[model samples]
Target chain A: MTINFDNAATTFPKPVSVANAIFKAVKQYGGNAGRGGHKLTLLTSEKVFDTRQTAADFFGAQTENVIFTVNCTHALNFAIQGIMSNGGHIIISGIEHNSSARPVYALAKKKKCTFSIAEVSDDPDETVNNFRSLINHNTKAIVCTIAGNVTGQIMPYKEIGKLCQEKNICFIADGAQACGTLDIKMSDGINILCTAGHKGLYGPTGTGLLISDGKYHITPLIQGGTGSSSLNLEHPDILPDGMESGTLNVIGIIALKNGIEFVRDMGTAKIFKHEDKLCRQFINGLSDTRTIIYRSPGVEYVPIVSFNIPDMKPEDVAEKLDQQGFCLRAGLHCSPLAHYSMGTTDGTVRFAPSVFNNENQVESLVKTIKKIQKI
Target chain B: MNMTAVSMPSVTLAIKAKRMLNEQGFKCTVKRAANVSENGCTHMIVVNGAPEIVIAFLDKYNIAYGKLLGDAMPQ
Candidate 1:
């Protein structure tokens, strides 16, 4: 079997429970969720509701506050676009994923919204201070990525969240690479928590979440049938129902439920320990003279490491590794901001280990990297 | 009990108020505020109970709500 190290992009080989949960949901409850009152539909809706509650509890939120979306991008859009639907100012971190940056820039162009980027530093205090300095009266929200996907750099989002709280600015966190692997609490001044079910959470793709702490105004991105308030043509003025327009991804959501269960049972601390151990092992094994690792790890981060070889493109190294039967993601990893922040403008080869990865795989990857760099 | 209407500054708070009241065995229905119809924003939580009971729940939950306008129509 090929060694998979691209956990940051999308986790591979999801927990058996996740797969089984999807199978069960599809086999037993194939009816469309929130569409009707039939037994099948009710059963489907019940599972969906249970999953929604599970996600909310896991994220320290309320059941009514949790809304599932297509992926982290969609969730982020719901938080970013919805909050700044009209013209408003927002503060974003410089190392944010495109999921955080693109939407704001799009709104700036389309909705006349403005945003300021808060530069990051290895010191969490410095980062927090930067974010604080950037905040102003007009700043309605602060959209931050929990960690940089490319560099595995963790931001002091909690500290920044507190700043947002003191200023009454909404905190919209992009937990794509951090959720399920990191200890995230919504009470830490996080208003809207958006995360991907496929990455870190070990669920199938096409599933994501936006959990609120009952403290923010998020204008619905899409307004359509919410399976509630059918009498009124206008979208019902509620939380999840107001934001959730169309039918949700039921099967994927059920799988996400099982994924959250796995994470909860195994405990995020334990999973993170295992993944971080493997990451450090691989980091220590890189003896190649041509290899260069980026960003000094200071704060807590997920098990993602980005490194590069001199005079070689990130994609080229990834292609060579692919030839050797190892799956890894190289290039920008969809975060030009991260690359520009770390001065890895050409991008870097990223290795993100998951719970399924072991020492043998890390050894193989490290050895292969050394071998490739010597050529 | 005269059906009382409770207005909120935003939809999120209105939904929270509705949820908190329901958990306390209060039957509260949510509808858009009549004055803000043209904007299609802001909502009110309608409860058949006294406004004091509703305000107490909103305060207990730390959710902000306002007195329904004397002239505002109840849904």
Candidate 2:
């Protein structure tokens, strides 16, 4: 019984319906979406549109605002580069993933743009205040991650969005780690949201999305044939066509449609409660362990826990755990900036539980960790 | 290859100069002056083109001013 605990990176054993949907699409209507007038093409296009609508409704966004991308990195690049080119100040969290941080760093170096970084706080209110302190006259945008990919510390987005609203700064959220796990709404004041379909959405890789309120226009990153206005050399200046250029991964999108539906039927609130309960149980069982160094207490974080056993390297621990048939992620998890913020330069073993993970698996994980600590 | 000089005060100005040089079909590499304060990012552009053409391009774009680092003429 291998216990998989790396849900934050990419979900495993995706919902059966998600797999079935992909299989059916490949076996049946495997055609280019929105390209041809054929029945198969139209059917595939409808499925893609349905996926977009489901995502919009789930995230409280308008249908036209949703644009598909290859992954969260692409979506984030589109938003950051597009907004920064206009020349304005920007604010980002110190705990941002490299996908968001690298672009801002590169642009800030090139553009005469003033930028500020809001510090993360263990307390949600203080975090919001940290963000408020950084805003100034020329501030153009605020970029935040819905949750820290490393710490799983959920940001107070509603308050931050409201602040952005009052200050008239574009509010952008990197939802790669939080989209399907948390209940997000556009009416809560989110201006732009980016998500990876492979994570909590339980879809295959090669699928992502960027949804905006259409207030700020983003210039296309890659310009090529969008299948619309093929004769024109210039790119079409439209909502989706402006951003989505070239061929799309139709099979991945088809699978994501069913994945979103599976999440919708299960209800995010219920999923949250279940994962939280499992996390609490795991934490409670390991409360007595003196070797484990757990950070960020008294905050409502996701079901992701990062801890290191005293005198043991995270990678070695992960190797041992793998031998014990427990799959987990060790090291910086590609967010070295986040690890720096948490002062874990050596990295820590992270256990992120998903809805499919059960209490028995949690028990086995806790027990295995306890045994490993003693060795 | 001809070399041109432009004075860029802020990091933003330096970056803009670098981007413009790259976009205009010039092989450019951005370097930082040793004397400049390292408190923030900096960029120095070295390009291959007519000195007057490069200087004019920078001037037209309103990039910050700097002295030509060396004397060189396009072959």
Candidate 3:
């Protein structure tokens, strides 16, 4: 049996309901969303709208605040670009994925905008303080990833959110790696949240979402036929219609709706407890000889781990595990800056478990890693 | 000779250069060096051709990077 451990990238083997929803969407209600007055199109639009409501409730956000996108990258781009014009300053964390890093860096270069990167710390309080130190009068926004994609570290969001609120700085969160996996309260002070429907939410690829309290508005990255405002050449200046241009990924949206419902049925508390137990069990089984690298303390972490065997390249270890029918992500995982910060320039193998993973699979993974370590 | 210039921020510029070289039927390899000015890592592409033609394509696509001169080209 194939032991998949790359749930952080995208969760695989989705629940039966997710698949059923996608199939039903494609077979029965395949139509452009919010485009035509036809019955089928309206039905598709309603299904998509229902999904938005589900996401809003799941994350403790307002219904109209949620906007669908192609993926987490698209959602992040809309939020970052929309909030700041040229020549503005923003704050970001050191442990950000390329999706966040690249866009911010590009904007910094093109617009000559200044950005400060806060350091990552083991203590949650220190982490919050690091962010506070970086803030200044020119700092227009603060962007953070709820969980580090590289180390599975959870940041001090509650404190940071309150700080942003007190200072009136925009707080944007990249929730791609930590949506359904972690419980996020909207009242906690986060202004904008960008997430992936495919990751912890257990939906297929090509689905993402962005949530805002409507305090900050951004121009759409791509403006074209949104199927509304057919008469005007200019883009519609409204909530989702402004940002959501072109044909919607209808099938993916329907599947994501069902996926969110599945999470609701399971309950976020129960899901977190199950994943935490599994992760702690896996960490306990590792011997002292294994170097477990992570940041952030006390707060719960996503079910992910990055480690390296002494005197061996991470790629070689990953290849050996692949030969044994175990799937894992090797190398920097598209975040070289993160690797540089962790001092793992050679990169580390990342193993991320999910709700679909069983304890037996964890035991087998441990045994496989041990056998490979001997070699 | 039409001279076009493209300025890539980092990393992605290297990937774009390699891809463009391959598409135009040229062999290319990406090289890495520590950029002291940037205080971080920087990468450049070593391609076998006239620099002007490469620069034009890169400029059209708005790919950002710098030019290599003298011994900077990989042997």
Candidate 4:
């Protein structure tokens, strides 16, 4: 059996309950949710709302504020573009996934707005100051990642959130990597939080969430039949219905409900500990090898660990590992900005563990890495 | 029983209102409101209780709603 360590991209081997929920939802929920009030539609609608409530309660948000999307990219697009639609300056961290980077870049490219990049520093305080120094009169919002995807570097988002609050700037956080591992909430001074249900939450790939604290008015990215305000040409000015314009992925959403329940039952702390233990084990086992680990002593990170083998390409290394029955992601990991910031033009292999991984598997991977270094 | 239909902007809001009202021992059912042509499409919470009490509960929870469609409304 292949041991999967590429959980950062999309968790593999989802909980059995999540799979069961998918099977059940496919058979039972066959109606368009929120389209009507028939028994079939209502049943689907109730299930959709139940998942929304679960997500809201998990994230410390009101039920109405949870807007579902296809993935983290879609959520970030909605939040970034929605807030910047009126045109203003925005700041994004230097190490950002393309999901956040590309949209902000598109806005700047279209001359709709201008943006600045805050260089993330080793010290959390200096990183916050880097963002603080970029603020100006036209700075309408600050888009940052809760934890970067490439190297799993945890940014001091709360400090930046406080900075946004003090400056009256809207703080939008990309929580794709941190959601299931960290206890995040709107109370962290974040105006908006976007994340993938598939990553840390162990949900299906097509589910994402955009949560708001009900403060800023984000223009809708897409508008269509929301089953409300249908007679009017204009989109309804509401929390979720305003943002969610198309029919939702009901099957994926119901499965996501079960996924979130699994997370809640296991507890974020316990899950983090399990994954982190695997990371530590991997790091320790690779200590005697020639592999270069990307972690810094003073920086905080999630369970992901990026490393490079001396004089070898990341993809080649990943290929070798794959032959040994291991799964690891290689390349820029869809975060070119992060690669540039780290000066890794070719990228590095990422080892991301899930709660299902254990020390024995990590040891085998570590031994494989050592064997690869000798090749 | 004095019944009223409370118009909510969306089915989510309507369902939310119904859940809140039902939990408090008030009878509620969600149904698509009769098309108010000029006002557009929306949903309503049919409550088998005082309309004033229903409105008060909605207001307390910050739930948004439109004008009441009136008493003895079609469910």
lDDT of each: 0.82, 0.78, 0.76, 0.91
Writing each residue's lDDT as its tens digit, candidate 3 over A265-290 gives 88767777777677776677675446
| Stronger candidate by DockQ (1 vs 4) | 4
The model with the greater TM-score, 2 or 4, is 4
lDDT of 2 by residue, B1-75 (tens): 566544333223344466568887887644443233222222245677766887888889756545565532222
DockQ winner between candidates 2 and 4: 4
Output the lDDT of residue A248, model 1. Answer: 81
Report the error of model 1 at residue A136, Å. Answer: 1.8
Residue pairs that clash (backbone atoms under 3 angstroms), model 4: none
Per-residue lDDT of candidate 1, residues A133-224 (tens digit): 98787899999898889877777888888898899999999899889778788987789999999998889999998888878788887888
A62-129 per-residue lDDT for model 4 (tens digits): 88999999899999999999999999999999999999999999999999999999999889999999
Top candidate (lDDT): 4
Candidate 2 positional error at B34, Å: 60
* Model 3 alpha-carbon drift over 4 Å, by segment: A295-300, B1-75
Highest DockQ scorer = 4
- Give the per-residue lDDT of model 2 (tens digit) for A83-157: 777778889997898898888888888865768889888888998999999998888899999988887889998
DockQ of each candidate relative to the true complex: 0.07, 0.01, 0.01, 0.66
Q: Highest TM-score among the candidates is held by which one?
A: 4
